[model samples]
Target: MLAASLAAGGFTADPAQLESPLGYFALYGDCTRLGNVLAALEQLWALRRHDINVKKHPAWYFTQRTADAALRLAERERLDPAEVRSIRVTMEPGGWIR
Candidate 1:
């Protein structure tokens, strides 16, 4: 709960289907800097992942990255430098943080 600030991804889906082979991906955290975001995207590219697609809208771009079975996780943004950290969690259908 110590995150600098919190924001939800616009991408929505059934929690049950989130773990599918091609799932929608949404990037969270301090996105004030485009370079850091691009670098993070580059890292995934280096992972031999071919589903990386940069869309017109960033939300759609990341969420659309997941196909059917995609990895779902949470991202934390630091107060300084706007660095982001990814956190893994199990989410239930219709479950969310308010």
Candidate 2:
């Protein structure tokens, strides 16, 4: 299930770590890891160029930014909602990018 959670956020997890939470903590402790992961996740959103960085904006603006980005990306990618298995719109709460 960890793999699937990572995939939902547009990340691929190591198979060897499938059963171990420690695999996560070790990678997470690296200073460069989060930025690298966020960069990878941005590729999944075709509308990234249009969306506001929610963290930089007011917290109340989050829902609108997320919904707009999802709609735009879905349209831009010519996505079929029925066939789409996963789409990530929200950042993890308190998950700082800086």
Candidate 3:
């Protein structure tokens, strides 16, 4: 719901989303290590009619290879920069930390 609202331009993302390293990592992690987070994000993206600039709004979770990709997307899209979600053990070494 929150992610949708942000994408729709209805809500400004929390500055903390961008500022907090923990929050940043929490939302956008590797799907391989965090499949559930990725899946939920995919579903959220699918809910909206507009095209989410995958470049602008990144997967949030990124691998070493995708670090630059995430940064570029953050600069361009700035979507849900502060939105946080609860954890559901969707990934290993997990619990929710956002």
TM-score of each: 0.19, 0.30, 0.20
* Candidate 2: tens digits of C-alpha lDDT, residues 6-87: 7899996577562344666355443235565466557756347535354533344445567667778889999899998976
* By lDDT: ranked, best first: 2, 3, 1
Please provide, for model 3 over 18-78, each residue's C-alpha lDDT reduced to its tens digit, 9 standing for 90 to 100.
Answer: 3355665455543333455456567755535334444433334433234555556667877
Candidate 2, clashing residue pairs?
A: none
Residue 5 deviation, candidate 3, in Å?
A: 35
Give the number of the best model, judged by lDDT.
2
Q: Candidate 1 vs. truth: CA RMSD?
A: 19.0
Off by over 4 Å in 3: 1-62, 84-98
Q: What CA RMSD would you report for each candidate?
A: 19.0, 16.0, 19.8
Shift of residue 88 alpha carbon in model 2, Å: 2.5
Candidate 1 lDDT over residue span 20-97, tens digit each: 334333233443355654676677454346444455433332334342123222223223323446435355553443
What lDDT does candidate 1 reach at residue 44?
42
lDDT at position 41, candidate 3: 61
16 Cα displacement, candidate 2 (Å): 61
